[model samples]
Target: MPYTAEISRVNPSCFLFLIDQSGSMSDLFPEVGCSKAQGLADAVNRLLQTLATRCAKGEEVRDYFDVGVIGYGQNIGPVLQGPLAGRDLVSISEIAFNPAKLETKIRKVPDGAGGLVEQNFQLPIWLDPVHNGGTPMCEALRRAKSLLEGWVVAHPTSYPPTVIHITDGESTDGDPSIDFQKKILAG
Candidate 1:
């Protein structure tokens, strides 16, 4: 049986976010009152920040995790935006330092007087809303396969990277079927 491994500075885990920025993602989500793209970007930025905080040691943040965010749409590949452009599998500290921009959002909060109070929260965004042609799930998975393959080769003893794949259920190029996975993994 395979035992669970402890996540420490010397032997840490990884997280790769696969976000779908296809045309369908431009639709406003009634539940969230925002586009899917916005929600996804917010979630990813929060995750990256949280990981960095968890790995902080004293004044400096330790590189205890490898993080990556890949957004696929018009062209399929890793997200080429903000400080993460042209980069893949960056350290936790890098993720902490490379937000595209931080915007303040005014939200209503419960006040002691039983009324609502306005609160400003900082929102970090690494990718913007991009509605383009094609879903291209196959190409995206292929890219992910390549990245994971390279990561596994480099960190053979570390825990396997966790991939959080979010899609809009559209595939224009081809289906990302089991055969696709087999083909990618086989090669």
Candidate 2:
């Protein structure tokens, strides 16, 4: 007699978080609490925590999911990292607190191990709706596409990639979204 055993089919998945740090996002969004930048950080941290927990449980997070965070705003450009790529995966809270800019002067804290630690994390330059000028969402999307393409090519056996593009305004670079979409889809 033949018997079948239960198996988890949660294959690996990749998620691209394309955030628009353009000036427009600075606009107040009631749901996000605080400014959009803060809201973005909150949401990202929450998502990362959830994934980390699931992964820890031998669930779909680590066994079958890779998270890529991309932030575009201010003059900081973008920050990219692959969470779950290693054991010492960076926490979402760390990412949330660590922005491209230094809010206050760097502080030094005693490590308690006979060493001193100099903290370098700074508050991110919140994307303002007026001061920053136009939104370079297109460029951010292109970067995401490149990253996704590379990830897909490298992990051919991985599950399909899901990209979550969050924006507060339309593209200032005409209609590059369609072209960008085509390029990504063709990859």
Candidate 3:
């Protein structure tokens, strides 16, 4: 029962995790119980692990669905952003070291089966708690569009690409959602 065995015959899919690294993300979100950045990073890491299993089972990590993550906010870094291939995602050590400013804190707990469980914490890397001002959400969207374009060009017939943009506040970059959606649909 390899991870990719089940989806080998299915079309490849790409996932673009567009994260909002805006200053407002510093606040605690109920789902994560921590800053938005920490929660997002943990989520992304879990997703990568899930996808990795599938990839190892023969699912084409890159050809099927190229994965890329773009972060925005005070200092959005594509630290965990890359292809779905094992080589692209951030290594565990990397996550422990320099997590993106927007990510929450995380720890690996024993899985009780000689493995470990990653526990999410409430710490953030780069969030600014500003009441008002600029939030570079549009910038992130634009970057996402660019990355998606390249991926779609290669796998045009593959499953529709998934671009997930996580933002906690309004866009300071103006109304880019509609246009961004259009680009995603057109692609």
Candidate 4:
């Protein structure tokens, strides 16, 4: 039978995000009227919110997953802002309770009828759009490997950690395949 590890507070999993903040990410997407960096940031923020919601149980948020985000560009390291600043990995509950800031946004939505209505809502911002320098993807992967190594050891029975890499350009550093093979696949 295939291994099926249950993800719960007792045996939580992990999700590590590798985001590219290279100069190319600043390029505007004419159709969306936003830069790649901005779009990516928005997507990640939404994903984080979804994950946090999934871990919510009534008034409390459970720690069903540990999340981490690493941005590679002019700098390479943990990118979580506000109370989560400089954190390599944090529990879902931490993310739910801590946001950099809340912004009120307006959007047009269908009002049940044929007409559309403007709605206002608050959005939590944990990461800001950033673009600069080269894409040091290899180094970022190396850092991810280091962070997960200990996690794997500690959570031997938990589900394997998931990594999501988002990039808009090729690596400016050395080839990432070699590093991936040696650092991740080797173990």
Best by lDDT: 4
Clashes of 4: 0
In model 4, the worst 10-residue window by lDDT is 178-187
The per-prediction CA RMSD against the true structure, in angstroms, equals 2.2, 10.9, 8.3, 1.5
Runs off by more than 4 Å, candidate 3 = 1-11, 30-33, 58-63, 75-77, 81-134, 178-187
Residue 152 lDDT, candidate 1, scale 0-100: 81
User: What lDDT does the true structure give each of the candidates?
Assistant: 0.79, 0.56, 0.57, 0.94
Q: Taking the candidates one at a time, how many backbone clashes does each contain? A: 0, 3, 15, 0
TM-score computed on alpha carbons, candidate 1: 0.87
Of candidates 3 and 2, the better by TM-score: 2
User: lDDT of candidate 1?
Assistant: 0.79
Per residue, candidate 2 scores C-alpha lDDT tens digits across 132-178 of 55666677777766777786686666666778877777877657758
Once superposed on the true structure, which residue ranges of model 1 sit more than 4 Å away at CA? 1-3, 184-187
How well does candidate 2 score on lDDT at residue 81? Answer: 33
TM-score per prediction, in order, is 0.87, 0.59, 0.58, 0.95
Q: Which residue pairs does candidate 4 place in steric collision?
A: none
**Model 4 — TM-score against the truth?**
0.95
Could you give candidate 4's per-residue lDDT for residues 1-187 as a string of tens digits?
Answer: 7669999999999999999999999999999999999999999998999999988989899999999999999999999999999999999999999999988878899999999999999988899999999999999988988899899999999999999999988999988887667755666
Residue 19, candidate 1: C-alpha displacement in angstroms: 1.0
The candidate with the higher lDDT, 1 or 3, is 1
